[model samples]
Target: MWLKRFGGGCSREKLRSILETPDGELIIVGGKSHGNNQYKCTFEFYDDAWILKVDADNGAKIWEKTYGGRNYEHFEDIVKNPNGGYYAIGTACNKKNPPWGGDYCAKNKSALWMKFDDSGNSLGKKHFTNGPNQTGFSITNTSSGGTAWVGESKKLVGSKWQYKAIFYKLTGTKVNYSKVVDLGGWNATSIELTKDGGFIIAAGKNVFKTDSDMKIPALEK
Candidate 1:
């Protein structure tokens, strides 16, 4: 057995998700600092979402890709598309706060989804904003050749702040369904494609079963 390492000249780096392609290649996605090696104790750091394609046998790096703006972009989850490509979900933050107001810029985070070709080239990208801040946690390929993802968001309700889970379905660049469901203020951690052409969302102590249309028809504790 052997160990392999990959990174830039940054002080911090992390790998969030890993997937094996149909041909046995490995794809890893995460975030890494784009700044210099100068270590800082504060939270002020510039980073970019990083994607790497490696040979499964020898762990050799085939290609690398980074996505970001002048701010930070952290990728949390990635899935291999059926069409010989990939889909990644995460959060993208810039210098400007969200237009919804109410301290959205306090964190400057928004839901981000990006599509990449087999060669690690970006095909398209989308930013989703349901409230002040939203961050995608998981993404899965749908049975209809589309994609579905779930995340957490903070919204204002009755002069108070409330947390909710947001779900979205996309087909090629079109949004099929976008729903915000309140799950008792618990963060929706992960989502999976069920065998019955549906989805199961795991949040805190509850599991939500949604139909093909992503409607919560049953909730399990």
Candidate 2:
């Protein structure tokens, strides 16, 4: 048995997802507290998303990088891109913090998707903002050679606000389709492409199945 840890310099870090490479390496993604890498003294780091690559044998570090915006931004899921590079999904906030009061910076947040190269260099990015609310919680590659992402979005209906499970797909920077599923939950944590050219998602206590276009049947909806 073996155990390892990282970010000893930071005050704290929270891991979100981990993926294994075909050649036996590991890709780990998470959020870390903001601070100087040389010293973990204060909270200036501002909560940013970070990725780390390590050897599968002894857990030795290969490379590490961080992605951040004006405020809170973090990765919730990651998936491999069929064309090349990798896709990462998370929540990005553009709001600035109050100088006197400690605000959560939850408002004005939107779903963020980014593409990175093999060495963790960013290539492109996209944001999905529906009614000014959506978070990127899960990502996967579809059968049509495009990337798909799912998450929870706060949508306003006729009178009241409702929580919606959002799904979207795109190739490169062009979005081909989008769908919203009422999964009776807060968010979808995982998703996978099925053999029948559909999608199977895990959300709350229910498993939702959808067609190629991400439309669920009446029985499943």
Candidate 3:
């Protein structure tokens, strides 16, 4: 394996996904400074997801977008849309001293999804959580003018953590949401829609199948 290094003063932290822009620019999607730090004072250093556009010709920074609060955040994947826009996916924590809906996630973690134009202006966002804890890792643009996000949902089933695969489809601009399709058990690692209007999803136990109606079932154990 060959490792090509970018000769620059690089910031250290947890790095995630990367995408290529239509104008031949390199878009790097990852997190900011992470790990243990002292003198910086008191708690674990939180990392936020960032988008850095590098000029392919000179390997120089063109622009960057950091998405997060003082808490932890990270982007798992990014997709370029047909309309010269981009989508970024990740997870975040709820820092509210008093959260809405009296949900457990008010004290736990939640998923985050964001979309932006080529110029780095945010278009909108989609967040998913079952009140207490949830997270999304993969995202894809749909042919039907929307997008899909895949991830795992963690909920307190009695006293144990129940892991379930989740898929959310975004439909409108006025805050309309798609039905949260539950894939029963197992963790969904990634999801991709096919040209035939079906979906292929890889989870921990097996590869599942979802029809155009978005009803998915595990094909194997």
Candidate 4:
């Protein structure tokens, strides 16, 4: 095998999510690879959510900020909200708790939702436990204020394995979580608000709508 090494300059792979601002600035969030992956099983390794302002002209980095705990944080997606600010969905594990604490770890994984202001400062961060593995897929703004996140919840029921499409909505400064919507065996992957003020959530093998009530229809491949 041919081995390649960097003399002195070295950079690791990064997972990135991007959002376009109203003024056309691009906002990127992802984790910076901490040198080599060798330190993971030993030292604390983190893939933080970092913001980068890139020049749309030459695709050069203008500004960037890294946000996360001393754990694994990877942003799956980013969205620009109607009220400004940006929302990100991802998973983090082995982290601290409360005002951003907790190793909400499970099977070596944890579900995470992190929000940031226009300036890249973290507005709020929350973690959810779903047995071992869980991840946040998408986020959308709610007309009623606050935001909504959809993802899959993997857990167990007796001796059987169960997967659920879960929804969580947060409101106010306290960010009180609303009751989760169980899509029964469905896995929610993407969420959007329909024109009628209803929510259209695409769950595995199914698409659903909820407007004070819930109804699901099979989505054909």
- Give the candidate number with the greatest lDDT: 1
Error in Å for residue 7 of model 4 = 18
lDDT of each: 0.80, 0.74, 0.66, 0.62
Residue-by-residue lDDT tens digits, candidate 2, 10-99: 555777898986567888887776643344434533567778888988999999888885346678888877665678998876554522
Candidate 4: residue 41 lDDT (0-100): 26
Candidate 4 structure, TM-score to reference:
0.71
Compute the lDDT for candidate 1.
0.80
- Alpha carbon RMSD to native, model 1: 4.2
Clashing pairs in 4: 95-102, 96-101, 96-102, 97-101, 97-102
For 128-212, candidate 3 gives per-residue lDDT tens digits of 6755666777877766766777787777778777777776766533223333335566767787888977677787767766775
Q: What does the lDDT read for residue 108 in candidate 2?
A: 61
- The candidates, ranked best first by TM-score, are 1, 2, 3, 4
lDDT of 1 at 221: 23
Leading candidate by TM-score? 1
How does candidate 1 fare on TM-score? 0.84
**Model 4: per-residue Cα lDDT over 1-221, one tens digit each:** 23222112224435456667877867776556443234532222445555666666556666677766655666767877677688787777633442222332443556677777777678888777655667777777766766677787776668775777766666633444533445677778888766776577787777677662223333211
Error of 4 at 185 (Å): 6.1
Candidate with the larger TM-score of 1 and 4: 1
Question: Which stretches of model 2 miss by more than 4 angstroms?
Answer: 8-12, 35-45, 96-102, 155-162, 219-221
Q: Please give each candidate's TM-score.
A: 0.84, 0.83, 0.76, 0.71
